[model samples]
Target: MKIGLFFGSFNPIHVGHLIIANHLVEHSDLDKVWFVVTPHNPFKKKSTLLDNYQRLEMVYRATKDYDKLSASDIEFNLPQPNYTINTLVHLEEKFPDYEFSLIMGEDNLKSFHKWKNNELIIENHEIFTYPRLSEGQVETQFDGHTKIHHVKAPIIELSSTFIRKSIKAGKNVKPMLPEHVWEYLSEMNFYK
Candidate 1:
């Protein structure tokens, strides 16, 4: 199977995420897109994130109805401060028959050069980048790179941070989240 790894914290999975994943799977050659819930992102503060399992549960709920989309806790057990290269290597070791690629937004592509062992990652895997309304130019090296593909998915401006703040301020952010995820968040009183 050709899988596209969409890695994120998924602080609380939202509709925007589902849309992007759905677009990638349905519009691209990827067989499925896995939401690799990160346990700890080296770039993000851990305190700002919900418990790993809680975030993963929200992802599970959000993706449950989509056959082509699924949640993965692949990075949960990996060493802390995990990098993409590490996860890619580990996943390849475990799923030898499957070809794994990356799904990222154009914003991330601008800073892709800073990622650990980025050269190795580009050499080994394909990158599927979607458009984003973010600042900064993509590295000149990536222009027309064979391993990198720019996917014309919708420009979703919604963000998990905005949803979290809205929920905390007693706003109705239900429309921003999946029904099951909204129910879970409401019942658990997360972020409020």
Candidate 2:
């Protein structure tokens, strides 16, 4: 079976995430998508991250109703600085029956070169990209991953950063994530 791996912190899973996963599963050849919850992303700011397990649960809550979507804790058991290459290797070894691909946003294209063993990633795996707005500029650059292509999901500007900022500012972020995820975040005081 062919599966798409959507890797992220998912501090709190949001509607935008759901949209992209839905698009990939419905429109692409992928049979399923696993939301690989990274315990620590090499490129992200660690200070702003929520607890790994908490974030994992939020992703679980958000995707529970979708049969094609799953939450992965593979990064949690792996070493720190959760690199995608290592995770991909592990998943391949663990699930040899499954062929894995990547899901990402197009704006982060330039940084793909900085990803550990990224050349292997581009050469071996298929990548599905979505457009993202960065610094008031809409960047759809594909970088050099010719294997990478844009998905046709509805444009969703929602972001985890935006949701986190709203939570820290004492604003209601319930509308950004699914109802179950909102409940989990509220009950756990995740962002605060």
Candidate 3:
């Protein structure tokens, strides 16, 4: 089984996230996409992130109907400041029968050098990157032995950072997230 590990904070699972996961499962060779909800991304500020349990629940609610899309809490059990390499290693040990790949934005590719044991990860797993507004074409134009694939999905100009800011300001975010996500946020008073 080929599983594409799509890691993110997913402060509140939104439509764009789902779209990319759906696209990968349908268009790529991946059999499923596991939304690895990170407990704390080493590169990002912990204070800005929502509780891991809440974020994971939102992801579950967002992807409940899609059998092809699943949510993972693997990082929650791992050590603090979750690293991709460590997570991938853990996944490999737990599910040896399944092949794992990475699903990320092209912009993240630009900063690949910064991730812990990044080169080691690329050497072992393939990468499936989607385009983002600030992302560049270096990932494709300057390819390496590392298996990197570029894909086209709905470029919904939205990010979790933007949504968090909107919620903090009490601004409208109907378009930022899916209907069910919005309802959950409203009902729980998250980001208040």
Candidate 4:
């Protein structure tokens, strides 16, 4: 099985994230897309993130109905400041039968060089990148070892940050989130 690992904080899984995952499974060579909900990102501020379990639950609620889309909490048990290279190594060792590839956005690709052991990631697996609504262009000039494939996923302008901000401002985000996720957030009063 060729699985595409879509790693993110998933503070609240929104439509944009689901759309990209759906696109990857349908259009790419991947058999499935696992939304790898990270407990902590070394590059991002921990204070800005929601609880790891909360984020993982939101991902599950959003993707539960989809056959090809699934959620993973693999990083929760790992050490703090989860790095992609370490996660990939652990995943490969644990699931030897599955071929794991990476799914990222073009915006992330711009800073790919700065990630820990990025060369190792590129050498071992393929990358499926979707375009995001960013201000500037992404530099796709990767070295020979990197296999970055651009996937034409529906570019939804919404993000988890935007949803959180809107919720904090007492705005209705029913349309931005999946039905189950929105219900859970409203009942829990998350981000308020």
Please report the candidate that would top lDDT against the real structure.
1
Per-residue CA lDDT of candidate 2, range 1-192, in tens?
999999888977899999899888999989999999978655676787888888898899889999999999988988876678999999999999999999987766667778899889888899987766553333434444478777766778898998988998999887788999998888877777
Per residue, candidate 3 scores C-alpha lDDT tens digits across 1-192 of 999999988987888899999998999899999999978655676686778888988998888889999899998888876678989999999999999999998888778878899778888999998888765466533266548888786666677888888998999998778777888899988887
Poorest stretch of ten by lDDT in candidate 2: 135-144
TM-score of model 3 (CA atoms): 0.89
Please identify which of the two predictions, 2 or 3, would achieve the higher TM-score against the true structure. Answer: 3
Candidate lDDT scores, in order, read: 0.91, 0.84, 0.85, 0.87
Candidate 1 residue pairs in backbone clash: none
Best candidate according to TM-score: 1
Clashes of 3: 0
User: What lDDT is obtained when candidate 3 is compared to the true structure?
Assistant: 0.85
Ranking by lDDT: 1, 4, 3, 2
> TM-score order of candidates, best first?
1, 4, 3, 2
